[model samples]
Target chain A: MTTNGGADLTRLIEPDRVHRSVYTDDAIFAREMEAIFQRAWVYVGHESQVKQPGDYCTALLGQQPLIMVRHSDGAVYVLYNRCAHRGALLCAKSRGNTGGAFGCSYHSWQYRTDGTLESIPLPAGYEGTRFSPGAADYNLKRAARVESYRGFVFASLSPSGPALAEFLGEARIALDNMCDRAPAGEVEIVPTCFRFIQHSNWKIFMENQLDALHPYVTHESTGRAAAELERQMMARKQKPPLEYHYLSAFTTPFNEWDKLQTVNYPYGHCMLQGYMGLRPRDPDTLAYEAVMREHYGAERTERILGVNIHHVLIYPGLSVQPALQQLRAARPLAPNRTLTEIWHFRLKGAPEAIYRRALAYYNLINSPSTMVNADDLENFWRCHQGLAADGGDWVSFHRNAGQDDEHDGVIASRRGTSEAPMRNQFRAWKQYLSSSEH
Target chain B: MPVVIKKRSRKKAITPKKNSFAQFRVSDDDVILREVEQFLYRQAELLDAKRWSDYIELFDADGIYWMPASLEQITGDGMPSIFYEDRNLMTMRMKRIAHPHAWSQTPAWGTSHIVSNVTLEKVDSRTGDVSVRSRFHMMEFRRDASRHFAGVYHHELRKTKHGYTIRLQRTDMVNGEAPFDYVLLAWV
Candidate 1:
């Protein structure tokens, strides 16, 4: 129950509650960066972000800076964004093409797209010394393991662990469903993303993703306003656009939310069943369905569209809404601060209207300017402030604790409002924090 | 309350449509410039006072409010932007923020906008359609935090029967890419 540092891991995380220090303590946060983030298969940039050879984008794995680049040989590599010579950042911008090689701004040390040292200035000065350009230390350090599943790239800092597929487990369906939704069986990332810094711990954001109970309460105002407008429009014999329902869906009563379900998987991954009837009989949707049916037969297209998933939480980091074609990656900055990048995708070969639907959801619900996100962010900040204070010591996850159905390490919540996802996440958290392996 | 009916038209509403204006030299540049400045300052005043309905009324029926995520973003369609909304969406936002249970507005924030650098980019001397450019620094204080948003505002004003109404208001923020502490609850 105790970690090597003598911190009581079991005390920090219980079956139905977690200690406040888990969300506030500096030592615990640092330990999480090492025990979980560094060891887990953390999500990097999608392969679509760097479509062409020599194209590169920077990402953060835990606190480590990394570069996901496409090499001339058409291979993608996730390398540490550091100059091996003087420890300066190799890629200064978020994304750009490095041409043939990355020339460090500080010392002009050149590195191939694959992270191997290509050349260095003043080779003669290092001939008599211990410096060797050909050594592995001089090359940009690559992540211990890098893997892509359907173009979604992930990297692990540890040299040994489960492969990316195993780490994903049943959660891989989230990615599969997204890719399957595309007519070409692929998805491309939208280049720009909204980066938001929440004044709360990373787990707070992750837990809220599949909470299921908070949407109606936290976003009641936004929902009510949309619902009211929808009512007025209906009274006028007018049909409101589907985008209004994106916000009004938050007005879904608590009982209806409970009728939905969440499935928890190992490695802290969890998924919430679809609640927004995304498949409407609108002309745009019908046209999109026709295009999908053209590529995939009726049965297959129906199967693809019928996948009832709303949100999937790949714990400690990513939250994906597969049907909506959007995902958010959380990067912990400090115990009290976390940075989240919100990225959405275009289902390849699908009608542009479908992509616009995803874009509508992205802007209406996920954008920083949205009332939905604003209220959620307020709750996150308030939660952190309350947790850090002396007012409370334990955060409860006691909603329907003993009622969950577990089969072979997979948990299915009896009610969608159940806090089983948090309990399941802490179960993985405890395992990662207590293990001496990394 | 005057209700703005939501149009069900499938037309791309937020797209920056080119207005057909007769290009001609303005005879009274000073008069037009002062009028444009006053209109902009009034818009800012409405925003600062949290006059949501009045602020919404400043826009024409088919007007758009856009805040691009970057300076290079020219088109709002198909690209991710901070905000790209038509009158309907803006009205929806206005109603939502005014809802009593809008938790994010709990300790209701206050915003002060300083409008400067008012320059007339173009003028349609016949119809009075004009393009105006100005810089704005908006300071928003909510709870214990104060944030500053400085941006350039490009307003395409359509001359209406009453006065000029905004056909498009595009904000290019200097800190559009910066890491914000929390959500932006209101327009800046």
Candidate 2:
């Protein structure tokens, strides 16, 4: 609420760099939770996460605990995970079916899947009191605005903002590409996810998403190791497994990474062009292609697969790898802690092997065990620790700074490894944080 | 080679042996159990000492090391897991950790694994296969912080002409689904 005493967000962010306080100061982080996380269109769980009427999954929007549940009417709802009676957590489990309604573990206050107050301990307790059971105040509070774009649900704690569609803009292509890959024109969450806490600021994770320059340098060991294995396989007169490329692709020289472009859209959404050649002419891929052709015809199938996207950074929170059927959602815990939920999806109507391919990539690259992700995670922590100290006053994002081509608000990096995405994100960050006064 | 995509069968790989432990008669159950505990302790020693080569050699040719994301996960199929590595991939993982270019490994991690509560669930002396379960508390220190990882480990061992080898090692951490801090390079 106050901008004095190192809380001035505008003063902290610039075109090509930002003060280290943005990544370290506790006050700035709290302001971020208020201005950016609560007000912005933050992603909730997907629709498929709660497919059944009683299904529910808990998530965090900023610091507020929220639940995304399916009602009996086949609609999804996002409600505060607090009991209306005594403010106890409504759902402690990450996800589970409530049969038909949720009952708070403490007071046994029950609510319908839609968050309506279903029952209380005793009806006569509030008979003549201000607490009317029928009043909306007695029910679990719903998010101010909740919307879904192609089954990927989002919610804003603030009532007024740009609509989700308007906010998504061209970044919707990331979701479209993911769903369009499914022959049935939809995808389903594979249920379990790799959840891990990063000992770094959430923004650090976001900046790393479209950071093309870091991979080949950070993951060099992994890339070279996989490449060496692939070469050994090749020397044995056998083609290497495509999964090897998932790691080896990080060995792509700087020139090749530079060739790919990063498109920075408004609202902090940005995407890097595909560098991982996913469309290999392998047997399993051919089989999957045929399945897609059977459902969507040859031209449409090609169109779906031809949309090349390696990774898409959806502002404050999400980093999506659509082609690989994986997306990571970042939940900021504090100035020094962040939780990331790594989820992988299955394209409906695709071959089981195709699902296997995505799952393999999920395990090989995004999973915590993989050296690819391990490398990034290490840097994130180190960056946070380094920034927290007095050694560095500013974090630089000057790579191809002014070289970006801006057209009608969407900025495209001249080079793949440009820090345009980080700059673009800070641009949106300042806009959101500054506008809180209004 | 040629993208060997091994599709997992829907059927459970290991079922509870039909007859109960009471129904089966094994050759020196106590001795075998003691040997199994010693084998697991030796494996932990190898891993803690960062003996990448000897640690890898403990695995059979067709061995697997899996760390499921959730305690309830039946299989790593269609879902992402913390770790799901075959012997070949596991070898590559070890190699990466040792590579000088692995910047994350600059200050190598020091680990101490405490494998306890060893319990044998099944023993197939005829087939030279055994299933053992244990609880582990692993402490790893790197950089400026130390991380404590506690998990339930399931090891499927096969008797060889020499002692035993690991066919599968699955670690189900108590809070495995929780977000972790930075890298988990050490094998739990």
Candidate 3:
């Protein structure tokens, strides 16, 4: 296929391969805001983030700036982060407590947490105009629709669409698996977060989340170093510290990475079976298990503890590792800009040590300053730059393409490194793009 | 607890000239602030050297090490951690990196921890509990590139028969109260 500046969208994307322009073009990005992200059930924030009324956190549902707030009556609402007056952005900070009412900075247009207009700075300023104190126009605008599924908040920009639960469907298991691991059946967001802005299309990240092939190659240097350190510790007859596992996991040869399984679900959701034996007989884990057995009967605890998902992509832009209580929210800044918020949770009531383990991953693998993240960032930037050149027209998802099992709309890749993840994401891209009015 | 710190100051800095070990009366019952300072310095060495296991052993069997999700107190909704683990968490953290599948270590991270401004506070002489405050600058080299990270940590500690273990290690970053910088994989 030759590069066409004015290309037919249909021919550019197949179930197996896609045009590079899908990631590099500027015009396509604008349409994507409406045809896909704006219409999908986008992750906003978790419920526990705003435990009190008037607590709010700013987030992006596609390109729209939205806020997730807990109202006085215990309901969570996703409101546009804009003011009713001169179009000022409310809640500029990523998160904070509003102390019972949201007051916009522009003119102090105070509104209830639910986005209802409470009081205007100058009530008489618009008393006789169409923008009354109680009129909907004077109130903060809200998302087309909002819903919270098991504490994870999701919002749809379009007013009409499949409800959040229906959209999640089989993929709801990703969120469920995380929550189920908790004894109290709940997880709490650790108050701090790590944020990084990647210089790549948002799709590059989503595709990479389940692209099991990259780990062994892209992260070879870090992996080899950690493996050497682990061996050095063992040569001295000393028990190797577990942190080395973080690097060594990447040193696995290509064949070993391919031996693992990857499942590509509908709506672009995908999961990679865990490659590490996280449940080692480490003293800390044994103690944590005892606490779990004490808190949530052994059988139930065992079931919760038994899930083997290494990572999950909640399509579009969420990378959730339920077992480790980690989640990353991706917001596209432009055709070539994306921001990812790295977050991890504490399984409420579990041992403090257990939370620390997740925290280590939060720091080591996902942190913007970590070696792993730095390496990945280089690749993402390179990919975006390369696609914009005359290098190639097609980005192949042809690896193990014909081998994917499609049963009732769900496609499961037999090998871990299979390109089904990219293929599945494109399938969703096609659906969202083709079904749109544009 | 506050009384002990003041008392030690009076005894050590009795004369305006210099605060030397000889200035204070030696008593095994009381732990000199410098001893605690030494413990912290040694811990920093372990981390800088990347002797993770030795770093892990610095904690007691039940010790807790935490890097607050934000600069504020570990309360409410932020992700709330650099780490939230006991020994098991430490073990798992070490284990994952040891695994052949762990990525991110593609280029080994060479880290240097500059721990300074140690504020050694006395918590309780009865329980041998002490609190320490310190500022740190961490620089990591990966793939010929370096990144700098800074934070303050509050450590409440208990002296055990064998050594000292952290009762609580709360890390407050330069961006502690807001959405912060660098995901913390290591114990800062």
Candidate 2, clashing residue pairs? Answer: A195-B179, A196-B179, A196-B180, A197-B179, A197-B180
Which segments of candidate 1 are over 4 A away from where they belong?
A: A1-6, B1-27
Ranking by DockQ: 1, 2, 3
The per-prediction CA RMSD against the true structure, in angstroms, equals 7.8, 7.0, 7.2
In candidate 1 the C-alpha lDDT for residue A292 amounts to 91
Query: Can you list the residue pairs that collide in candidate 1?
Result: none
TM-score of chain B of 2: 0.83
Give the whole-model CA lDDT for all candidates, comma-separated: 0.89, 0.87, 0.76
User: Per-residue lDDT for A68-97 in model 1, tens only?
Assistant: 999999999999999998899989999999
Clashes of 1: 0
Model 3's CAPRI class? incorrect
**Top candidate, metric DockQ:** 1
Off by over 4 Å in 3: A1-7, A290-300, B1-188
- How much lDDT does candidate 1 score? 0.89
Q: How far in Å is the alpha carbon of B126 misplaced in model 2?
A: 3.3
Please give the C-alpha DockQ score of model 3.
0.13
Each prediction's total of clashing residue pairs, residues at least 3 apart in sequence or on different chains, is: 0, 5, 50
Return the lDDT, model 2, position A293.
95
TM-score of 1: 0.94
| Top model number, TM-score | 1
